[model samples]
Target: MIKDYVSDITFQNLSHKHMSFERVFRNIEQFMEKDPTGNFKLMFGTDSQVFSRETRFITGIVIQQERKGVWACFRKVTIPRRMTNLYERISYETTLTEEVVALFTDEKKDSLIDIVLPNIYKGASLSIEGHIDIGSGKRNKTSIFVKEMMSRINTIGLKPKIKPDSFVASSYANRFTK
Candidate 1:
């Protein structure tokens, strides 16, 4: 039933149906601006699922400031045909994460960091993390591809997380893939 490839660069915001990257970026900006004193983690990750004759991928962009609040949104990309290769799918997922991360240029990241720097002594901070859906457990089918995928994420300077700790990818993004 899958038609063809579709790419949606706009993000799905909690308060709105679709937003351009700029709006989504500002949304988080306003979110953090509301409480710059809370700890923050800006996370990005991607996950995929195979439908009847195609594959659908969803990438989540999340910002969590604990007690302050958490903001999340996702973008979807689809391929016309089902992709059964574990390695291929995982690679594509990581690629999607990288692409999204690139959108938040160094200048943009520094701006976000600027918001939390003054409170560093007070425990306020920010970290950018990339989550890959692959795992390292022996029985995990995606285990074999962990190194390659993590390396890809690492090349872009994102602290990579996997399996149990990679909820952004395995959980958040996975929810939208369905």
Candidate 2:
């Protein structure tokens, strides 16, 4: 079974047992090798759902390769620390996404960096994006933090995605958090 702490984090493929981080990277490498011309994007995002006593945070790492489709793995944590403030909650979510990105980028494999395409200029490069669960829609108060969160992501040299576009967080991670 999957645990809620990073130290015990496990990623699954289909119905099989959870795989370690190293194995996950190896799988991604093999997938890329099989499709050299595939358009790939490596995105990290997190979303949270608060309950009465604790909050659940789910972070997801998604590999989106054109034609090959999308593959994602997630780890979740249920914390007793309740974040009643909206800003605090959003910041925590961003931090979770950042942590996941750091784990992937800090890997010893140099080739992993080449797969992270941050811009179009890099030929067939894999882009690493942070999908923030904020939007510009007036109905949602979270929209107010879009600029602030975007700036934070930009300062870290990563592309930021808001709602309607931040499916990795608002959609993928959201499913597990609930």
**Top TM-score model:** 1
- Give the clashing residue pairs of candidate 2, or none: 116-126, 117-126, 117-127
Taking all chains together, each candidate's TM-score versus the true structure is: 0.92, 0.82
Model 2, span 1-178: residue lDDT tens? 2224444666664444577776777777876666655678777788999998999998887888866788778877678977789999999899877766656654533575544444335456566688999989989999889998888777666789998889999999998887
Cα shift from native, residue 98, model 2 (Å): 0.6
Off by over 4 Å in 2: 1-9, 12-18, 106-110, 113-123
Error of 2 at 80 (Å): 1.1
Worst 10 residues of 2 by lDDT: 1-10
For 1-178, candidate 1 gives per-residue lDDT tens digits of 1112222467784578768788888988988888788799999999999999999999999999977668999988899999998888888999899989988889999989999988889888898899999889999999989898888888898899999989999999999898
